[model samples]
Target: MSTQTEHPPAGGGAAGVAEPGQSAAPGATPRQTLTLLTVLLAVFVVPTSISGTAVALPDIGADTHATLVPLQWVVNAFNVAFACFTLAWGSVADIIGRVRAFGLGAGIYAVASLASALASNVIMLDVARALAGVGGAAIFSCGSAILSTVFDGPARGKAFALFGTVAGIGVGIGPSLSGVLVQGVGWRWVFALHTLALGLVLLALPVIARRTTEPRRQGARIDVLGSVLFILAMLLLTTAIVQGSQWGWASAGVLSLFAGTLVALALFAAVEKRRDHPMLDLSVLANGRYLALCLVPVAASFGFVTMLTYLPSYLTAVSGYSSGTAGLIMVLLTLPVFACPMLAAKLVARGVSALTLIYVSLGCLVVGDATLTLFGQNVALMAVAVPMLVTGAGMGLSAGLVDGQALEIVAPEKAGMAAGFLNTLRLGSEAIAVAIYGSLLATVLASRMRDGIGDFPGAGDPATVANEVAGGNMTGPASAVDASARGDFTDFLVRSYDSAFHTILWVLTGICLVLFLIIGALVRTSRDGREPSAATGSQAAG
Candidate 1:
């Protein structure tokens, strides 16, 4: 939205060619090209790290000897930190130069990743991953802002298109590539690889700093109190969701966590309202339509991202696939994401309804989650292929479309604030969705295992064994069962995991349908996802 009205350099001398006088023009083609590639390269790895780490969870658990409850932090920690700090990073980028913020973020990411690779225990690894998430927040939020700052008009569109594509590639291929690395090089290399890629980004920072220009905002502040409150609130809420089933939903600890989350949120809201430069711009959030569009990503988080993070582990445990094979199979579900954003955008541009595409996306998620129930012991791959593709396509279609549509309803100057809020919801929900899914899956698996395992001749504690299996250790605990009954117990573990997965899928279907209804009612967008009585110019309602 920061459309620097500057046109392409008249002579076009290599585009971005610095001249004797005048600041390096933003329309500098060569410089913009370098900036785009560099920023995209940094951002692509963020999603790869998000989707890929799950493939290595089992290995991390096996190596660290941790249970499911503690091990899930490996993913949750990163996501939660990213969600909480993203807005702060954006604000910071406004105060400091974007290039410096980017360099700082890249540095943190590289160091944290290196620390993660060297961690000796699960706790150490979780802390390191959380640090990386903080770094990732800056990279993800600031990268697009950088692109918006550097390129204008047609070139901007192309840059963002590539941005979305590379990110999708990262998400789509994360599981497959990670599985290979885990199998061939050990799990440590997973983080090691992140360190390596980000290091390259860091090395390019010198060139980037000299080439790019961002005017620092005069009076912007980071809103530390608001940031802390929001982060504490999210962490508490996620913790409560993760522990609710295990601690008894009504237990004092669970209730207290929920209560604490509410108090923190109330404080955050109050702080935002009072602050001169709040982390969350309350005025922007008052728009009903914009808020509804933000939820679109939340739906994807629950329906698709949950699957991306956990399905690999599920397949390895219940469907009898190795880590590498499970990752390969996941390609069927994630590949569509790589191509569908552009396809969806073109369709909208061609006069197809944007809301219609959203509905299609939501519908596909519902259908896909429901159809995935077909997966069970020895299930044929062909049977689940359609469901995976449908789900991934749903995710793909909405990729960057929601942000684009959301921007249409806001004043151009407020685009940054709106985007910040949308992404906060996007990533915050992802953290919660994944936490809840894993918790509920383990909860159900525990119940099933408890009901059936006690009857066996020589079984370990059902709760403990279920936790172990959920954390990706299937064989270690099977030793407790009598040799005659070991096979049956292992079979029971597989059946229980499959059953729990099916239950979770159904819940996801219901969530998606409800989201669709809520968004449909809120927008009143015509068949094409635009307002019925839309305004003429570039922006509609705003």
Candidate 2:
């Protein structure tokens, strides 16, 4: 375990404002206020960048001539890199210094965003996105560490709450900003705009650097082998899941990837269990409270990401809305997300359990998804927006609680590992959700359309006809078919989409229900979710 010590004051004034990681003098102004804003801005930038790109994806596809699968990779590649590199960066922050690592990440992120503005093809765009993930990982890994160092007790709680709000708000505001950017300028300008803000953040780093001094650690060894094994496992598993539908679940390529993932994970476990300073601390997984908290974020975030991918399609296809209008509706789903962290913070102060808040938020997710599933096409805009608001709020409130809970189980020295583990679980869960839901929806829609049109009179080879229409190959000879045939095919496709959409909702509902059960089984109740072990000088177990 790492021992923390206070730095002797080099001078006075705001520069000596407790110097982060130290007790303050009487009437001292806490650094929490400044640190909160800085960390919030850093944290918000990543998600905002993600959402911004998402809203402009159609334009990107058109400009770069990217197919749907390529488009999926453009998003998935960044996620993969972020998931893989996060733990390594977290450990690096612990070894070198948080501020240095943070600045490095910001520099990389800025450069990557700028590079993406000039991408001429999907391949180039994906590379830029991957680099952006590397930067994002650095920011995410160190931001919380900085917060932990700067604030204590109630102030720390507020700081973390503010951090969560920034993240949630970034997600909420991303698409809207992207839409406006695309409308005002070209799509390329959207990527270009990030550099301006990033540049300002970069220039401000020196001031932040002077305020805090990080004490160097001795004999800190990074588990290079463990990190490699972990990344390999994640990559293989994600590849298997994401490509399984297109490749066929039983195909040799998919099966081999699945097998490889299992083998790598088993090896990773053995290696970590034996390592002196493993990339992740396996023992934390044994902590019931931490494990329970992990489940909520994985489940909720999974559901949320799926909504990000499919909601727009649903809006434009079934609700007779334009893509821009669909993007606007998505804002309603994300709007509550921004407010959730603040709400949770207040609730926590009033003696609420993090688990309790997570449960309530997850419950709202269930209700919202269920309502959407049941009446998506039939519901009025107001009706749909209400449930969406509730769902978004729930996700926002619970987003950062998982990290806090995970941190509680480990000793202070292992905070980086705990954070890394939680992040890994989250990324892995998100990938799985995207693959599973996507495959299920595709299959159900196709099957439903086939069945809906099967018994119609003179409808020979309905399956072939349906496949052609769904694949966007309706032109050529297919279009030369009679008007009645075209109308029947259109009706079948629409009905299939509706059925599939409903099926997806029901499936998500079941997942949420299971998540609710998992939460009840795992979390031990606490007042305001604080252990008081670190806040006070109480002994936390080894």
541 Cα displacement, candidate 1 (Å): 6.7
lDDT of each: 0.75, 0.69
Pairs in clash, predicted candidate 2: none
Candidate 1 — worst ten consecutive residues by lDDT sum?
Answer: 8-17
Whole-model alpha-carbon lDDT for candidate 1? 0.75
User: Highest TM-score: which candidate?
Assistant: 2
lDDT of 2 at 328: 80
The runs of at least 3 residues in candidate 2 whose Cα sits more than 4 Å from the true structure, single-residue gaps closed, are 1-17, 20-30, 58-72, 213-218, 455-481, 524-542
Q: After best superposition, candidate 1 residue 249: deviation in angstroms?
A: 5.6
RMSD of each: 5.6, 5.1
In order of listing, the candidates' clash counts read 7, 0
